[model samples]
Target chain A: MIILDRRQIEDLIYLPAAATAIRDAFCSTSRGEVNLPPVGHITFPQVSGDCHIKYGHMQGKPDFVIKIATGFPQNAETEGGTGNGMSLVLSATTGAVQAILHDEMVMTDMRTGLAGSIATQALARSDSRTVLIVGTGPQAMRQIESHAAVMGDHLNFEVWGRSASKAAQLADKLGGRFAVRSVSDLETAVRSADVIVTATGSTKPLFQSDWVSAGTHITAVGADAPGKQELDVNLVARADLRVVDLAAQCLDHGEMSHAAVQGLIAGQDVLELGQVLLQAATGRKSPGHITIADLTGIAAQDIAIADVVLKAYRAKGGRDV
Target chain B: MIILDRRQIEDLIYLPAAATAIRDAFCSTSRGEVNLPPVGHITFPQVSGDCHIKYGHMQGKPDFVIKIATGFPQNAETEGGTGNGMSLVLSATTGAVQAILHDEMVMTDMRTGLAGSIATQALARSDSRTVLIVGTGPQAMRQIESHAAVMGDHLNFEVWGRSASKAAQLADKLGGRFAVRSVSDLETAVRSADVIVTATGSTKPLFQSDWVSAGTHITAVGADAPGKQELDVNLVARADLRVVDLAAQCLDHGEMSHAAVQGLIAGQDVLELGQVLLQAATGRKSPGHITIADLTGIAAQDIAIADVVLKAYRAKGGRDV
Candidate 1:
């Protein structure tokens, strides 16, 4: 099997292609063309760390993906730990090891960011600009790059964070391609933005429901696990259109779970991203629609992205070692 | 990460050490010291192939292991497939990929064979001499090698299979160190042997219950998944000592499951290998006792064996590639 390091993986990513693949993967998952077993999770409470194992195979696909992503917050303090992860691509026909991508969670962030961009591009108004991103992290950077890659450089961007210096730093790093700057007032950013993406690890709601205006689209990316919430339950309930990557997953965690728990929404009330992509379910109806896409992540995305990477490696004549 | 191929893994294995590690892993599992998540599986019905993902971490250990094993019987007919598998060892402290062992199911077979030997050595009578192994497969070879590795080479071994030539070939291949010969009459072989090991993918009992004699110990090694059985349900229910690797897994799809479905056994009736190893449960009670160990395999064993391989590599001054 060929082993690609994180740098090699980063060099191979084409956000536009990845976005397309991820969109198709979302559809495949909703259409029941993939086998996604229950995720395996191991928690280390002593160090506040946890590891997640997600694996799946899409029907008719050449390869299956087994992904392992881990988080150790305490390690960052002394070990300079940036969460590590890798995905293995194996032949679906013979179950032979095909390739190993030691991307160190880069693929995860890329696929997630692509999901955010895909949802935003499909739901946000065509004339939308002034996209606001909450939090200054790797995902925040990915959100900007993927959105720019898929949505174009015509849209203006604003970043908001608790620390002004960090937010400005992020803008400076990503400022070459698009118009981006740091903003201090989150409320104003929420009210005035055409689209909002919340990517923080906060357990409580990041913003109030009343701050969001009509005709706005929000993609909540941070609340992918239990006890994580990025939007007010009322905001989720009040949205005119609700799109999710997967209903079962979104209901178990993520931003929609809070609304679901409060009896504001049921499973049937939500439309999957795949369904929307397939036109099996309706997306935003009018400019007045307040749309939300809750992405809790899924294994299908990993399989899709891995396939994309493997294709790139093959094109480059990468040899098995 | 360091990548070790099948040959490297084979050279690194010390069967006695592996048996010890597997035995300790069993004990750790029963003591609730390991975080073993439910296994993930995907099936490819068109190819009659299936892949299983088992992973876990033992508390206080330096690393965790995620194992992927796949079986593609149809591929063997056309693609010269011998099955494929790999294990990833990651640091538990930071969850970083430490080493990758692309053993191609070599590690799997070794661990399984070692489990059989460990159980046999612990339960079989000291004076036992004649050993009978049913079926001629890789597992059958592993059972013979591992049994000799742990139980010494003084005992006589008999091979039984439907095809006399295949059984004779197996016996000839393994006849260098010990007395081994292919026997024609399975009933005589089973009745005369002091110990019996069944290692086949048979879905039905290989031998009748009445074929087994007093003072015999049988290690049923092939009924790992559902729709597979090597011992009659009556034989399983009739054993004086019922030992299992893990009660839940064994009862789910192994030889024990058949007896369980017939309401012939319950969870409490079986003694886990770890419990017996820890002296928390009984093994063979008398010289005339009939004992059986049903192993469905567990992630803890994979983790244990992976650790053993990784240590061997490190000892050789293997550098990160």
Candidate 2:
């Protein structure tokens, strides 16, 4: 099997290529052309660490992908930080492993960042300018970069977090590419931003529904597991257009689960991003309507991006070129 | 991270050492000291293939293991035979992957074989002489070798399968070690053998209940998934001692599932092998009693054998020795 390290993965990865693959993956997911099994998870309370195994196969594809991603919050204090992951691509015909991409969580962040950007571009107003990013972490930076890759760098960006200095550091780190700053007033920033992206690992809602305006768009990516929430339930229920990566996943553990449990919405109330990408379902009914895109990660996205990386690696004369 | 291929893994593995680790793992499993999540599976109908992901962490252990094992029956026609698998070991404290053992299903077969032998040694009558293995797969040979590992090579061995030539081939392959021969009369073989091991991928009972006599110890390792059975429901219900790897997994997918589903037995009717190993439960209540061990396989066994392989790799000055 081909073994590609993190550096090799970064050198081979192209965000635009990943964006296209993810777009196709989103569409395939909604068309029910992907076989996504339930995720396998192992949590270690001693170190506040957890690992997730997600695997899937797209119909008629020559390959399938299995992804292993891990997080250890305490590792940041002692080790370099704890976003580690790898993807295994295997042949659909022979059931033999074809490649091992040890991307060290780079692919995960890129795919997630691309998903957030795709949702924002699809749901946000055409005239939108300012983008607010919550949480000062690796993903926050990725969200900024991916948004630039897809939507250009003309828009202003604001970073907010519970740690003011960290937020300032994050903004300062990314200020070279785009107009960005750290904001202390969350409510004011939430109300003024054209698009808001929440990426913090928070159980409680980050902001109130009343703070968001009518013409704003929100991309929530924090609540990927059970008991995790990012957007307020009222805001989720109040959104005019509620779009999800997958409706069943969102209703089970994503940002929409809280509102769904409270009887605020039904399954039909939300539309899959794939459906919108396929133009089978409408997105952003009007500029004045509030749009919310719940971004819970899925295996189809991993398979798509892994396929992209494999193709790029092979085309570089690695194998089966 | 260290990546050990099939050859290196084969050189590092010792069956006695693996058996000890598997023993500890079984005890830990029954003691509720392991974190075994639900399995993740994906099916590829186009190729008649399926892949299963099993992951777990033993309490207080330094590392956790995630195993990916796949089977493609169609591949045997063009390529080699079907079994393929690998294990990933990661630090529990930091969630960083430490080692990847590309054993290519060797570890899986060994662990399973050791479990069967361990169960047989623990429950079989001390004076038992004849052994019958009903399969012509890789696991069948592993069972023979493992049985000899735990019980010595003095016993007689017989191989039975649907295809007479395949059975003879399997028997001939292992004739160098013990006295082994292919048997066409399965009923007479079942009635005569003191120990029987079934390791086929069958969906129906291989032998009737009446074929099995008293003072027999049967280890059923074939039915590890739903809709697969090797023993008749009557045989499972009639066994004086029905031992399982894990109660929940056995009732859900093992040979015992059929009996439980048909209301022939309940959860309380069976005992965990760990419980029997720990002497917390009885095994082989009487010399004339029939004992059956239902081995559906467990994540704990994977963790155990993977731990063994990693330690051996490191001890040879590979890493952190």
Candidate 3:
């Protein structure tokens, strides 16, 4: 068995490969040939721990991936503690325990970021240049990195955080690659940017419907837990194209929850990310259309990244038996 | 994080103190306060891999354990290959990824054996001496070790396996202390044994109804997966005391599946192992009564053992940050 620490996994597996694999898996899953099961998870409000276990085979792939991830209240940095650990188990067709990945938190961040990038790649217009990133944590940084990687070469980036100092620090870290600037005004950033990414841990909507402009792409990466909202229901209702990782999950817990509660977007109106990836339908048909991609994360992404990590370990002469 | 190899975990962590902790955790879980979620597992009948992802917390425990175990068909001969590879992620109440255990297979074996030992201690009479072990696999060996350790003093042991060499090998290895003998006839071993254990991977019953003697205590540990049976339905029907790890799981998948299907025993007749352990009711009231413990391994056991392993690692100077 191969055991990989965070650093080892990061160094060996790149985000581009992982993202591509995830995109492929998502498309395959939509085709109904992939054996991905409905996720089984439990939220223990009393103890403050929630876990999701997901497993399945990617169509035409030789191996299967099982991901077990848990988030505990005690591990929140804001709660004066480190966050809970996450891990993935990758096994092959021959039943060998190929790799045990120890960098679950990083994996989660990267895969989640890639989901946003994939959505933007499909939904955002090619000429879209200015991007607004709300939140200045690790997840926000990863979103910036992934968007830059997928969009490529020419785009202006703006950052906003609850703390001005943190926003300034994030702007400095961007290193003038895309006219990085700190926006003291949230509305100004939301109105001007061609694309917006929200990575906050807010329990209420941070963006209002009036702040959003026409012809902008929005990626909502936070609001994973119940009662957590980052975008107003009106904003969600106004979007011409709304895509989700899993429609059922999003309606239950994603930004779509608010829209669903308001009866703005019915169950049938929400399109799955897989459908968009497979090109079975259009994502952004017009240049002036408002598109929103609500990502609550998916297990297929975990499995895809795990497969990449396992392959990298094998290439580096990792032990087999 | 602390990552222990199989041998290191075995040598440094296994102890009576750990066993006691696990037992206590198991007992507390039966009180209905802890929420142990159902495990997510996949079976590859097309190939031969069996993968399981289990997560839960013991009652009053500070950490949650999530274990991923996979059995490889190709490496079944290695020390731990027949069983799946197990990894434990310890998420403490402080919300830190406190530790990562890499040798969960060994810990699982120890904990599973302890479950049987704990059941026998609570259910079997003090005079029960002769032991019969069916299916001479690693699990059978551990069952023998645990039973001998818990039962103490003089005990006669007989082993039966499909392969005569395997049975003889186990007998030779454990012969000195327990007066171990290899028996060609399974019926003879079952009839003579006061305490019988069935740990085979067979899909059909290994022990017949006529084979069991009165007052015998049987621990069936191998019928964990669906359609895996180790004792005849009639034998279960005649059991005076029927104790199970989890009645729902046993009725759906374990040795009790056949009995329940044949209408031999009602679902309500199966007693939870914790209920029996707490002595809410008698296990074996009369000297001539027959008893059976159907152990379909539970997620709570994984949580219990993970607690013990993490504690042992910390006590031995292991660190996680």
Candidate 4:
């Protein structure tokens, strides 16, 4: 099996190519060309860590993918420690392992960010320029980089976090490359931005219904597990059009999960992004319509990104690695 | 992360040590000192291939293990193709990956065989000599090798397969080092043997209920998934004492599943081998009692085996990959 380290993956993976592949994966999934089960989880509450296992295959593709990603809340606090991630790509026909990616959650973050970018491309207005990111973490930076790569460099960025200094520091770091500002008030940032992306490990709502603008499209990327919410129940209920990366999973754990439990929206009411990519339904009908895409993430994103990264690595003459 | 090949694993893993580790794993599992979820499956009916993902952790342990194993029934028939298996061991406290074992299902067979050995040690009669292996596959040989390692070399072996030549070939191979014979009549072999191990991919009964003898301790090592039964329903129902590697899983897909569906045995009646290991219950209470241990394989077994293998590798001075 080929072994790929983090540096190799970073050098080989292209976010724009990943976006294209992810779009195709979404279209294929909506067209019933993929076989995937819901994510499997092995939880450890004592150590404050958990692992999520995702496996899937495209109907006629050459390769299938299985990924195990860990989330340890205390990883950053410990020396020489970090959350873990692994992706194994195998032959679809022969079941032979093709590659092992030791990404340490970098691949997960990249795929998640690309999903956010895809949602913005499909649901957000074309004229959208100002972007507000609700958290200043690795995921937020990845999302910004991918969005900039896909949506052009003309867009401005605003960073907001519970810790204002972190938000300002992140904004200052981004200012070296693009137009960015850190806002102390979340409401002013939410009202002014045309697009919003929230990626946090918060247990309560960070944004309310009254803070959002009519033309804004919010891609809530965090709240992957049960009982984690980033948006208020009423905020999700107030969106004119609600979409999700995976409808069943979003209803169970994403930002819209709270709204679902409150009976604010039914599973049938929330559309899938794949359906929108297939043109089977509309994501955002008008510039005046408010849209929310709750992305809990799925296996197809990893499969899509892996396909692109492997192809790129092969083209770069990295053989047997 | 450390990378280990098949050869490394074969040279490092010890079956007797693995048996001891597996017994502890069973006890830990029964005592609720392990964290494991239900096995996750991804099936491809068109290609006749499926992948099983098993992962778990022990309480207060340094590492946890996740294993992904694929079974493509047509792999052996095709050119340059084989099934795949991989295991990732990560630190429980930090979630940092420790090692990757690209075993290609060798670890699976080894652990499975050790489980059978452990079951035999706990349930088989002390005077048992002749052993009947119902199927002449790799797993059958593994069971024989592991059982012989844990038991004694004085016992005789009988090989029984649908293809008599294959069984005779296996017997001839084993005869080089030990006493072995190929038996054509399954009933005669079952009647003459004190311990029987069934490892096959059969969907129906291979041996009848009346073919078994009293005081026989059979370790049914196959029928891990749904619709795969290697032993007759009546044969399983007629066993005086019944045990399973994993009760919930065996009741769902192992030899006892069909019996459970037919209302032949209640779930509570089927005791776990862990209880026997813990001395909470007696296995093979008397020499006259016919015992059956239906092993569907669990994550704990893999975790147990991995821990031993990793420890052995570390002791052998294997460095970072």
The DockQ values of the predictions, listed in order, are 0.73, 0.83, 0.36, 0.69
lDDT of 3: 0.78
List, residue by residue over B1-321, the lDDT tens digit for candidate 3: 666677777876565766686567656767775566776777766666677676776656666676767655555476564775665655434434555666747777787788888888777777988888897877877888777776675777789999999999989987876778889998788888889888887889897888888889999998877878988899999989899988888999998989999888999888888876676666778889888999978878777777676677778887765
Worst 10 residues of 4 chain B by lDDT: B75-84
Put down candidate 1 lDDT per residue, B265-302, tens digits, no spaces: 99888989999999898789899999998988899999
Superposed model 1: Cα runs more than 4 Å off: A77-81, B77-81
- Candidate 3 Cα errors over 4 Å, as ranges: A13-17, A32-34, A37-56, A59-63, A66-89, A94-96, A234-238, A257-267, A309-321, B13-15, B261-267, B310-321
Clashing residue pairs in candidate 4 are none
Estimate TM-scores for all models: 0.96, 0.97, 0.89, 0.97
- Candidate 3 i-RMS (Å)? 3.2
lDDT of 4 by residue, B77-182 (tens): 4221245687889887777789998888888889988889889878989999988999987787788888888887978889999999989988887888777889
True contacts kept of 2: 0.77
DockQ, candidate 4, vs. native dimer: 0.69
Candidate topping DockQ = 2
Clashing residue pairs, backbone N/CA/C < 3 A, model 1: none
After TM-score superposition, the amount by which residue B105's alpha carbon in candidate 1 deviates from its true location, in angstroms, is 1.0
For residues B1-321, could you state the per-residue lDDT of candidate 2 as single tens digits?
888888888788799888999999999999999999887878887777888888999998999999988878777632224878789989998888888888888888889999999999999999998999999888888999899888897888899999999899888878987789999999999999999999998899999999999999999998877778999999999999999998999999998899999999999999999999999987887999999999999999999998888889878877741
At residue B28, what lDDT does model 2 achieve?
A: 98
Better of 1 and 4 by DockQ: 1
